[model samples]
Target: MSPFKGKTGFKRILNAGGYSLDGLRAAFTGEAAFRQLVLLNVILIPLSFFLNVSRVERALLIAVCLLALIVELLNSAIEAVVDRISLDLHPLSKNAKDMGSAAQFVVLTMIAVVWALILL
Candidate 1:
C-alpha cells in the first residue's frame, strides 16, 4: 500500500465537505487578490443599498462583483496547481499565470462598466 493510504481519518474527511471548505479557506488565506476583492465587495454591497439605486442596478452591480470573485477564485486555483507542479520560471507557467490575470482584468473592466452606467 502507498504511504498516504495509512490515514483513514483523513480519507473520510476528504470524502466529506472538507475539500470544498478547504478550497474556500485557501482562497481567503493564501490569495491576496481574493482577500482584497472580498473587502471591496463587503463595502460596496452595503453602500449600494444607500446609493438610491434601482433594483436592476443593484442586481447588476452585485452580479458583476460576484463574477469578479468567481474569476479570481479560478485564477487562484490555476496558479496553485501550476505552482504545485513546479515553482521554476517556466514559460508555460508564466503564460498560464498571465492568462489568469488577464481574465481577472476583463471581469474587473466589466464590473467597472456596469457600475459606471448605473451610477454615472
Candidate 2:
C-alpha cells in the first residue's frame, strides 16, 4: 500500500512537497534569520527529547521552537515579496517588514518562555 491517498492526490502531494522544499531552500539560503532559527531548532528539538519532562511538556517545548521557525519563514516571505515588488523605500513596505519582524520577535520570546517554564 502506498502512503499517498489516491492517484490524483498522490500527484498533488508530490507537487506540494516539492514546492515546500523549494521554499525551505530559499529561506535557508537567502535569509540569515531563517538559517539562525534553523540552527536553534537543530539544537533545541533534540535537546527537548533528553529533558526529564512529561510527554505534554516535551511536546510544548518542541512546538514553540517550531513556531519560531514557522514565523521566521513567513517573515522572510513577506520581506522577499516586498523587495521583489520594488526596492524603493515606502512607508507601507516599511510597515509590512516591521510587522513581520514583530511577529518573529514575539515567537522567539514564546520559545524562551515555554522552554523556561518547562525546564525550570
The per-prediction CA RMSD against the true structure, in angstroms, equals: 4.4, 5.4
Give the alpha-carbon lDDT of every model: 0.89, 0.91
TM-scores, one per candidate: 0.82, 0.90
Quote model 1's TM-score: 0.82
lDDT of 1 by residue, 1-108 (tens): 776555567676775567778887999999899999999899878888888888988988888888988999999999989999999999999999999999999999
Worst window of 10 by summed lDDT in candidate 1: 3-12
Instruction: Output the number of the lDDT-best candidate.
Output: 2
Which residue runs does candidate 2 get wrong by more than 4 Å?
1-8
lDDT of 2 by residue, 19-51 (tens): 899999999898888889989999999999898
lDDT of 1 at 48: 82
User: In candidate 1, which residue pairs get closer than 3 Å at backbone N, Cα or C atoms, i.e. clash?
Assistant: none
Query: What is the lDDT, from 0 to 100, of the residue 92 in candidate 1?
Result: 100
Top candidate when judged by TM-score against the true structure: 2
